[model samples]
Target: MTAVSPHKKEPYERMSEPMATLSAFAAMVKKEFIIQLRYPVEFVASFAQIFLIVVVLTLAGLMFAPDGVQSESSSDVTGLVVYGFVLFIYLSDTLWSVGFNVRREQKQGTLEQLYLSPASKFAALASRVALTLLWTGLLSIGAAVLMSSMLGELPFHNGPLALYILLMTLSGTFGTGFAFAALTLRIKEAANTAVNLLQFGFMVFCAPFFPFAALPEPMLWIAKAIPLSYGVDAFRSTLMGYPNGFPELAPIGVELGIVTLFGVAMPLLGFWLYRKAENQARRRGSLSEY
Candidate 1:
């Protein structure tokens, strides 16, 4: 009998090039943009809701002012206070918007399908966060400016402050969002409740309505420890002409540094937790169960 030839096997595939990775990222980004465009209601609602908040706050501020003075001004305490309020709203809202979107996708079974792709999960998540953050920040700032203009003026001692606030806000908000996204991977049912509670907490502790000094001795330090407070402090200083607020409540540089570290760490941590949750769901065969 003739000897049988050993079966030949195909060579291993080559690693993907840098261009291919960029292409994958671009594709995911496009997909996110398309989804956002299709759901135009969300954008409209976001704009309307922001506008309503601005109007309500403006009226409330006017009502509470000592008289013969506006809630916001180029100089003095009201502008700083209002800036703090606006900053807290912006940061808290950004986190909620991203968290809710993640929860919805998780429930709809799309998140798992996203995991099935060969592209990095972090890249996909980052793209989504980037798009949402960019749009929401713009909307929030525009609303704040328009409202302030109606009531008074924005009180920007320096226009560069806007860029600083934007960077710091993006860093802190996205960092916090990563933590929430990780939590959702494991605790889908309680995600919204958790986010709502956190949002309220930020409003109370980190916003202008309350001063960091007003907290109890123990809690005063705790408030300063939180990232959102640093954000509020930064915006308070820059937008409200309260530059003296810097490096006191919290330094802008330190907050930015901490937030940057969190930005890097939280996403990595989130990705790891997400993978674990995905595997657990898959093993239980409940990937699409929500």
Candidate 2:
């Protein structure tokens, strides 16, 4: 009888599973970049829109203060307006990246393939989130600089502190976006409408463009309920030297704590919800239908 060799898997073969998962995630990020670059006009339009928003806000600011008062409050308001818009842009873009990406995949009939892949669903979602964060973060910085220059005000006081606040703000925003992604998976047909409504709701309730204290009592309660409200307060205080609207708690630290809780809780909740929705879709054999 011929010598029989015992069947054994190679070391590389054993490692192939994890390696493939990483490769898939990396490819997803690269694909996002490529897709954005393929439409050069859209890329340019994004930047143009940022610049136009700054111009309109600047004009309004000038009209409000034609003499350009040099008071501290005036300077703070200018910084608040500029940086607030930057934060809003980042939040909106992140939400779009997560929610719209899922909707697009479903519409193209590719989402089912992703769901069937060996890679974890969260990994795929995170890759898109990372891409959006990088793209929107750069745009936010550029927009902040342009707004500051046009408004004749410098917003960066403590560079390191400002950077920390920015990261915290992004964390909170990403959590919100992650939840929106789950919502998109559940409501693919109305995903765009949901996203638009969310953006508008945030603008009104979070008080990104205005002072939280300026809001009425009922609205103030709504603002307090939203984590982005705390994020905006922290960002404004850190980047613009503005006073914290919620003075009951210790300035930036308390706000950071609140956002940290949100940043941690929301994503976990979103992931759980997403997995359930995905499973339901798979069970119904409707993953490709949406």
Candidate 3:
């Protein structure tokens, strides 16, 4: 009599690593949408909330405009405010959503089981990014169009370069999201506090609502040091055709270099950090601890 094996490989168990990772990613993305659909009210509320904020901010900018100074009627001002808001929407969503998902998994006690599965951890982290991009893409576009109509025509120049900058900025933030996910694994629920701190911090330091020159000298110095600040500066400046005194942090070339480095390097570093944090959680037997 021949001994028979008891184990049976699942369908995708036979897939190559890349295919398996892709399959897992697609599954998680679908799961995210399904989960999201369970709360239609939240989506409506979110859209309304963002739209209100955009209206308030646009009005406030017009209110603050001095008659002879920084004309609110200037499309330059419109592009500055609206364009920066676009990056703010994305960065806010990326940072908040990614970290929140990780903490949720930890509390649900599935974080450990997820780590044990053969599915790519990177893909799991990326699924959150995919969802954030979709949700924020809608919110940002709505905000932009509404603001453009209120503030005046939007200046869109250097089209290709502006898109490249936008892509790089988004990619860079995705990497930051991964790093935040790593921190969530360690900090657990305290991650929410960190998220608020980061959310407000990005608003102030990244200067998504106004020009960097409007920042106090000390704050401008701080903004200069943050890579995302360069992203905000470069993106809007490029889109506005590098008008007088634009790209406030550095030369366009220098800003481009920094953003490119951030887009390239941060993902590698963030994923590496996430893997380290995850391993520590698993080995310490604290993956399920909240």
Best by TM-score: 3
Local accuracy of candidate 3 as per-residue lDDT tens digits, 1-290: 97766785555448788899999999999988999899999989999999899888777767766752235478898899899999998988898778778888877777878887889988999999998888899888899899988888999999999889898999999999999989998988889899889989999999998898889999988888899999999999999999999988899999999999999998888899999998998889888899
Ranking, lDDT, top scorer first: 3, 2, 1
Across 81-123, the per-residue lDDT of candidate 2 in tens digits comes to 7777878998898889877888889888889888777776877
- Candidate 3 overall lDDT versus native: 0.89
Which whole-number lDDT from 0 to 100 does residue 50 have in model 2? 80
Scored by lDDT, the top model is: 3
What tens digits encode model 1's per-residue C-alpha lDDT throughout 1-290?
98756874547654577666676778877887898799899878977887887677667666756663343443434455556656665556656655666777777778777767777766666676767666766775677677667666556665586466657566656656766776676677888788889887776666555456666777767777776676666656655545454534756677666555654565566566656766787787765566
Instruction: Record all residue pairs in model 1 with backbone atoms less than 3 Å apart, i.e. clashing.
Output: none
Model 2 poorest 10 in a row by lDDT: 241-250
Candidate 1 TM-score, C-alpha based:
0.79
State the lDDT at 171 in candidate 1.
61
- Decreasing TM-score order of the candidates: 3, 2, 1
Model 1, stretches more than 4 Å misplaced? 1-17, 68-82, 158-162, 208-210, 214-218, 239-286
Q: Please list the C-alpha lDDT of all candidates, in the order they appear.
A: 0.65, 0.76, 0.89
Model 2 local distance difference test score: 0.76
How much does candidate 3 score in TM-score?
A: 0.94
The collision pairs in model 2 are none
For each candidate, what TM-score against the reference? 0.79, 0.87, 0.94
Collision pairs in model 3: none
